[model samples]
Target chain A: MTINAEDLHKVAHLARLSIEPEATERYTQALSSILSLVDEMQAVPTDGVQPMAHPMDATQRLRIDEVTETNQRETLQRLAPATEKGLYLVPRVVE
Target chain B: MQWEAVIGLEVHVQLATQSKIFSGSSIAFGAEPNTQANVIDLGMPGVLPVLNEKAVEMAIKFGLAVHAEIPERSVFERKNYFYPDLPKGYQTSQMAEPIVGLGYLDIPLEDGGIKRVRIHHAHLEEDAGKSLHEDFHGMTGVDLNRAGTPLLEIVSEPDMNSAREAVAYLKAIHAIVTYLGISDGNMAEGSLRCDANVSVRPKGQEKLGTRCEIKNVNSFRFVEKAINHEIQRQIELIEDGGRVIQQTRLYDPDLDETRAMRSKEEANDYRYFPCPDLLPVELDEAYIQHLKETLPELPEQKRQRFTEQLGLSAYDAGVLSSSRALAEYFDRVVELSGDAKLAANWVTGELSAQLNREGIEIEQAPVAPEQLAGLLKRLQDDTINGKAAKQVFAALWAGEGHTADEIIEAKGLKQVTDTGAIEAVIDEVLAANPAQVEQYRAAEPEKRGKMVGFFVGQVMKASKGTANPQAVNQLLAKKLEG
Candidate 1:
């Protein structure tokens, strides 16, 4: 249940987060402790216990289908870094 | 060595709900960018998402139509990914537990047989925004209008063997979704799309080859082409001593080839976990049973009824019932005209041809069902011949007149069934063509039977194509003999 520095670096890369090279060891130690806690939690025997998604014991609330939003392109575009022609502009992304 | 392609499809159809899946934003197409996007869709802070009821109902309807199991409780999970179109940086989808499960669809194969494709499961998810690749000052433009639109992702097992079966299976999905009225099924509008998983293995091999998933196959034809190309690529690679690598590929319709996606081809890990914002959706049996009861007649049942009750040929029935709009059009025409056979012929023949020519859907056809039935009524009562009916149909399509009777009166296209009028034209034809008449008399009786066609044409021509063909035949025979 130990996470090495390389594993932490890979995890950061996948999450698109940048961490300093010197900070990798500290983050790895922190992640390893978190994993050990998970290992401890999994050690408990709970056979036949149904896994639950939420502790509230409630269901999702439903909304009737309706158009409750209006044209707020100008207002929303003001929050973005860049915009043109009512579109949110971002760095070039291709798939 | 013969290699067989094993194909599976993950079809994503947009539910025709008024609002978004988890937001109250409008899901209308072709809207101005960001206009339909609300706070919830924009992933704004302090905003919570509530499930739209109509989306759940649509999922249930599709599940029942496909004979899928409706799990009383279904959970939504967050699929962690990074993309500009996804403002939330994670898409809320279903993972270990989906709403609909274990369905089977009976897709008709090209070899005149049915193949039962096992449905792995179908899940509901929110769509991402559109990333306009057009140059925006060396950047990409994002439109959030479609961000929260509801999509039902139907996943199938690896049961299809060839491109033909793949297309047939996709078509079956299209028909069922349209029939259930859950999706608009407009591929061009991005309402219906699919991702194809393709692999090729040696013949009789039990183990599967490494599969590559081809994304962005937006059309049915492209699905077939992409899968075939991927299959060929894998088989050729194996033959050349290269191992096939599992990856995600993009289908380039312009080049008709599948290329590996640029950045994420090495590996993709979407760490999925239950979404904390949305709770599990619990459905009762009563709601599911109500949907099953009120479900519209699906394509299979309609096709069967058309053949068994309406006495339509299987081919004709299939053509009519291929789409909901076309089938309902045929049904209304049959009801109004009271002739299923004739209605099937017109709907599958002339109307289909015209719609294809105009590149218009049946819902947008210029001539309504009542208008077509009115024209067929004139045809039924001998008010107009088949040729004249076409003329009336054209005129009606061109908005020349309202009804068939009006067009017949205006264009003088009524059939002349009266024996007296036909006989007069027959006399004139025989007198004007004396040289031919003499030759007809000198000819043998057996040869004379074919010779009468010339006189029939002349009589009908002299009557301006108004002479009834059967009456023209009889009168020409008697006068030529006498």
Candidate 2:
């Protein structure tokens, strides 16, 4: 029901965000208040109301399988920081 | 400690669709790195992904084959993660409502029995790109050619208890996908990939033990080895007064050991949510029936027909029916040649060996099924002996002649079935090899039976390998005895 600084830190780490030590208390307090608002909404829910997955409830439209895109590497690679041998280079990751 | 391992496999079969699952870019492998990535797959802003109809149909096809429930409504969810290969921070996958549900596969066991492995579900998703580490000089090179390719991740219940059973289950999955023509099921090019969940408990324990996931074991042999090694590691950890840590482990094939992947250990929280851009896919009974009509006879059906109707052994039936291409080729050969036994022998024997030696699939072989059936007919009618048939087959593969009769005529490989002509050659061999004849005659009774091999060899050589070996053996036995 309440968010602590440790939980805030874990969530920040999962989102790949580095939060300053001084700002943890502020973020934790803000998250806890938002949860209390959700708690209030949960308390006021009607007993027989059905949960809706989507508002329209329309099915998705599918496209037939075909290759429609052409090579845009020259235009796209210009936006990257580095490239070599037609490959985009990044920080080394081993799996 | 008498530990028993509980294992399950997660297989990702790349659907053989022409384009990306959600984009129009080509999913073709081995292209220039960034050539295949379009704006949408590259995670540009405000771009929505549209589902591919063929991929959805493929998912339904697989569900029908396994007798799984094809849900009227299936939804795709976004699994949030951070990886350099994944340009989008989250992967679009199916979590709660997968397309295929509650399937079962009957795997053939080593003892000639069938074991049913329960399937949890299978879902359709897009694949990530590849990271090349070797040539990047401390920076990873990313090839997005494989990105957005359609993959069906089939999850199984914890039904198998050993590596052998797990492999069997994986093989059954491979057979079905390849049979359905939905996937190529090639492991070397990463078409079919697998991850394993393994745990160990005391023999009579009712509750399950904690499990470790062995991730991305790509090959069949490696799947067996990885599961076995993980089982051993877990058992040893429990016996050594240590509790097994639930984490992901990587199997090192060179060392034959599994070690915890520290990076992936703490990163297990995949907060999944539905993608608002894509609506739930709804399929009606009419669409499901259409796909069901397009389905071919599956591997189990073909295997049963081969053994029961064609009078083949279970092993031969299984081998012939493992792939659609192989089974279709065998069927055509049998239809043309009118001899199922001979067709089975050649297709599984010489044709398979040649295909294996050339490192090609049966569909890509140099000789066609009709051509092979023609060559087989020659052998059936004693037009060419078995040895001559091999020569004819080799010639056919070399493109020397189009049909078996043409090659047999050109190469003079026809069998010497004429009794008078064969007798003339046998008489000549007996006259020229007077010393061997005296030795064969003076030998003891049992020794003489073995000694007749020399005269048969001489007659076959004297006839330039065109003599029927069986006729030569019979004549040699009679002539040597007299």
Candidate 3:
């Protein structure tokens, strides 16, 4: 499948990446070639083989159900751009 | 010209594990804003997600409870999306292979029949944080405490035909999870939530219509109302020559209307790929078997046992077995009273009515199971008739007495079953109402059937409503008829 400028713009918007109009064509071509490579990879025949989810076939490492973390609101809120009343504040998100 | 609604439900059940699914942070609700959020939950750099074993066990328990296929291996994938509440840009969720696969639940419908709702799959995922829109000036406050909390997203096949069926399906799921003790199943506290996919088609159409998903309906009542509103909206849209558009809609409970939250085109593609950080979850046969053996008697089995073995009606069984606490309470009542029918009635009728009026759960009832059983026992042994039993129940609810016998003794509410006392009252009633007695004797037997009730009432009134009604009827029949 070929990626168009409009599709690229939609993706960029969804990722919250503001792409300049002049750079749209270049990014589209680059991303489209990457997608084409993926298309070519998908075209390879591998009928009976199971799809690989991870690099190695292994089970998940289990952890005991315990509360090991303490309150770190002050420590974590130090990185926020804006905070008030122990909350990370952002521009209002309606819906 | 007839439109039929097709409905399916996706339920998000928050697991009751102590910590978040991927992090060791506390998953307890109502913690101060960011207190429960750790570095892992806040998506700090270099932090990896370690799976919680209890969460996986809970998910397996649910799969076993539903008799679903537990895959030998399940993989977690990153569902890419962007929102302020999601600290990480992508959420770790199972997509291609979920833990529970291809199960069905038999939900008891109102018409004394069970409707089997087919399950598509149930996957485990993490919840996003809350975006509090209030109490901030032009800014949203984010509480990351809920972030990384484990959630089991149960998807159902589009088998429901009405709002009633959808609600039944939700209730059944709620009962199952709560019974398993995996989740508290409290909708108001956001432990359990539902999203409904609804569409409409012509009455006999085999092909499905365009469906709109109503998202995050928290309450069962709201779910029913939202589906009804959406069905009406879709039918009207189709009837007016406007095609239904597939989109995500939000149910506005206040307005009782579903509004478009986002169109299909604006929705995210959610580029899903297996998470490299976490390994595939492989379950051995022994582990799955252990979970199956450890599973509790589920709602359907309990309901069937109540109906068939205990001889309770289907409705009573359904009501009693709707929640684990209620079923346990009913069982304790039956065990103590040794009367299954009476226990069923008292639990479903009097106790339920009191609980509803007080707006409390069965666990918070002022009257304990033994207390209720005591009252029921009084009713059974003719110690108190139904009316006196109700009075004793009211007294128990008001904290007037600890046991049924206490209230019965204190309020003089026990039935007077002594033949001599009843005969004296009957004689007084007969002598006081000479004209009525003469009329009863002169009246035909057919008319006397209706007339005899007056004497029974008078007898009961003379005895201050403590006389046994059947004994009163028998005595009145012997005296007035002969």
Please report the candidate that would top DockQ against the real structure. 3
- Cα-based lDDT at residue B126, candidate 1: 97
Q: What is the lDDT of candidate 1?
A: 0.90
Q: Model 3, stretches more than 4 Å misplaced?
A: A1-4, B438-445
The predictions' CA RMSDs to the true structure, in order, are 2.5, 2.6, 2.0
lDDT of 1 by residue, B102-153 (tens): 9998875544467899999999999999899899999999998989899999
Please identify model 2 stretches exceeding 4 Å from their true place. Answer: A40-51, A91-95, B1-3, B134-139, B202-206, B235-243, B263-266
DockQ of 2: 0.72
Q: Which candidate model has the greater DockQ, 1 or 3?
A: 3
Clashing residue pairs in candidate 3 are none
TM-score of each: 0.92, 0.92, 0.95
Model 3 alpha-carbon miss at residue A69, Å: 0.6
Backbone clash numbers for all candidates listed: 0, 0, 0
The pairs that clash in candidate 2 are none
Q: What does the interface RMSD come to for each candidate?
A: 1.2, 1.3, 1.1
- Chain A vs. true chain A, TM-score per candidate? 0.92, 0.83, 0.89
Candidate 3 per-residue lDDT, tens place, B1-482, comes to 99899999999999999999999999987888899999889888899999999999999999888878999999999998878898888899999989999999999988878999999899999999989999698999999999999999999999999999999999999999999999999899999999999999999999999999998688989999999999999999999999998889999999999999855555558989999999999899999898888888899999999999999989889988999999999999899999999888888888898889888999999899999988988888889888888888899999998999999999898899999999999998898999999999999889999999899888877877899999999989999975
Q: What C-alpha RMSD does candidate 1 show over the true interface residues after superposing them?
A: 1.2
DockQ of 3: 0.81
